[model samples]
Target: MPTPRPRPSRRRLLLQAGAAAAVQVVVRPAAAQEPPALATLVAQFAGPQKVREGRVKLEIAQMVDNGNVVPMRVTVESPMTEADHVTEIAVFNEKNPQRDVARFQLGPRSGKADVATRIRLATSQQLVALARMNDGTVWSDSVDVIVITAACLETTTSS
Candidate 1:
């Protein structure tokens, strides 16, 4: 006759293993998020085709006292005719919470391909303006502006 040995309970086994195992809590530094570049955002709209560097003018101050409301003007060289005109105009930024700031849709009937508005910038960076013509050609221009007071500033609380 042979004697059988009893198996330990699942709770008892976990308790015994817990005593020998070491628990560690690792804290990792939060990675800062960076916005995409102007080129990257333009490619998203016009693809990787070559964009002409002229015909589009970006009028903005070289230095801005406040980024909350920076005046901007975008004018494209076009006849504004039904045959040849500016189809779309887009504004982009290098460093901001959002890469694409504004987009305006226009046509020959709009009288002109010029747009004037205000935009918010997080910091001093390059501002790009792109225009898509009716001929399927894309034109662009950029301006570098220094912002004294940045927008989109957030307040963080420590735990």
Candidate 2:
């Protein structure tokens, strides 16, 4: 008569599963924990459309003493006619708790695709300005600003 094989212990199976789970945690290394990257935010805003680097211009100070109200202007080169015009302009920040800073909607009667305003910065990071045309084409421009004093502070509480 052939001898019956012994079944693997439940303890051994649990250890194997634990080891596999640990490996996954080590490989990912806080990717899910960390905030979304700037590119991800841009992708979410642009939706599947490709963003190009042209037409839109972002003008802001390269360096600022305070981030409370940093001035900026976004301008796009387009003919404000029913045939062609800028539909929207958006500003995004890399370090802010909210990726979206502002969004302005316009139409052919808007005359020009220019917007100037002040924004608060949490820290020194890149700012991206985007323009969406009536044809669904997207244009972008980015600038890096150094902030001496941060206007926003992010705090995390562990419960």
lDDT of 1: 0.83
Q: Write the per-residue lDDT of candidate 1 for residues 1-159, one digit (tens) a residue.
A: 899989999999877754433221112123523245766788776765678899999999977879999999999999999999999999998888788889999999999999999999888778889999988899999887777679976679999
Clashes of 2: 0
Tell me, by lDDT, which candidate is best: 2
List, residue by residue over 14-110, the lDDT tens digit for candidate 2.
7886687456546654433324588887777788799999999999997787999999999999998999999999989889777788999999999
> Per-model C-alpha lDDT, please?
0.83, 0.86
- Output candidate 2 Cα RMSD: 16.0
Which pairs of residues clash in candidate 1, taking residues 3 or more apart in a chain or in different chains? none
The per-candidate count of clashes, in order, stands at: 0, 0
Worst 10 contiguous positions by lDDT, candidate 1: 21-30
